[model samples]
Target: MSSPEQRAAAILASQRFVVIGTTDADGPWTAAAQYRLRPRGLYVESDLGSRHARAIAVSGTASGVVYDSSAAVADADGVQLAFSAREVDATEPAVRAILASRLPRDAGPVAELDDEVAAVLAVPTKRLYVLEVERAYVFDRDAWRSRGTDARIEIEAADVWAALGRP
Candidate 1:
């Protein structure tokens, strides 16, 4: 059994990836986009006025998937993780600057946002679901842990919200 600190480290160390889920008017929407893991959260880039930017504005909720396929390539054990997150717009100059420093230049300039484009995507995690693989056997973390999923050490939505201090 892993300790709480180990579990936390596991989550923190996992490389982030992207998945596309869809929304109609103002909820979860779909699109396959590339993203990377950062210490703060998941970071993705898109232009303003794009479907993703608009959907995030309308719904404020989104989901992403990250897989540890390294194991597949390395012939080692691995896990796939899914994240439910809320998107925060990096529209403010300061936020844009912070994102700019972390993201590539082609993503869009921090200062030169076209009237129609959004700058950056700030995805704060709310929930995480992980699937573990052992010797080609796949199982949910709960099953691997011999307990309910809730029994695993994870940050609750309230804890994430408090840490972000966002409304």
Candidate 2:
């Protein structure tokens, strides 16, 4: 049987999509996002006008989960994470490099997105947000009558990104 820590590392490495839940004046909101896993946490790129970005700008907090959709019920596993999001300053060379790595499918190359063209298209400059994971939990799929999962493990990797080197 695989340990939960191993399950979490696999999830973080393999999953590309996550649903982030946030709060607004009305109530709770959720956004489906494409994310990249880094030792720093989950790195997600979004434009400023996106509701996801707006919400993060307002609250700087969110929660999300990632899992493999193709797995069978008995074999399924996932990671639940609570995190905070902060905008990355694109002017910094290191930060811009990260942003460049997440180019939009609809957009042309970075050089083509000059300020003039970008402004006319309402293409808000890509903003990098790191989901600074606060709490991470690993679980498996089970029957309704059972405890949510047989082996619940709290992933403490968020403290120092130790999960990155899980062996």
TM-score of 1: 0.43
- lDDT by residue (119-143, candidate 1, tens digit) is 2323332211111111111224554
| RMSD values, in order shown | 10.3, 5.7
Report lDDT (CA) for all predictions.
Answer: 0.40, 0.68
Per-residue lDDT, model 1, residue 77, is 25
Candidate 1: Cα lDDT at 13: 43
lDDT of model 2 at residue 73? 68
Q: List the residue pairs that clash in candidate 1.
A: 21-29, 21-30, 22-28, 22-29, 22-30, 23-28, 23-29, 48-117, 48-118
**Which residue runs of candidate 1 sit more than 4 Å off their true CA positions?**
1-14, 20-22, 26-28, 36-40, 70-92, 95-97, 100-139, 142-167
lDDT value for candidate 2?
Answer: 0.68
lDDT of 2 at 17: 92
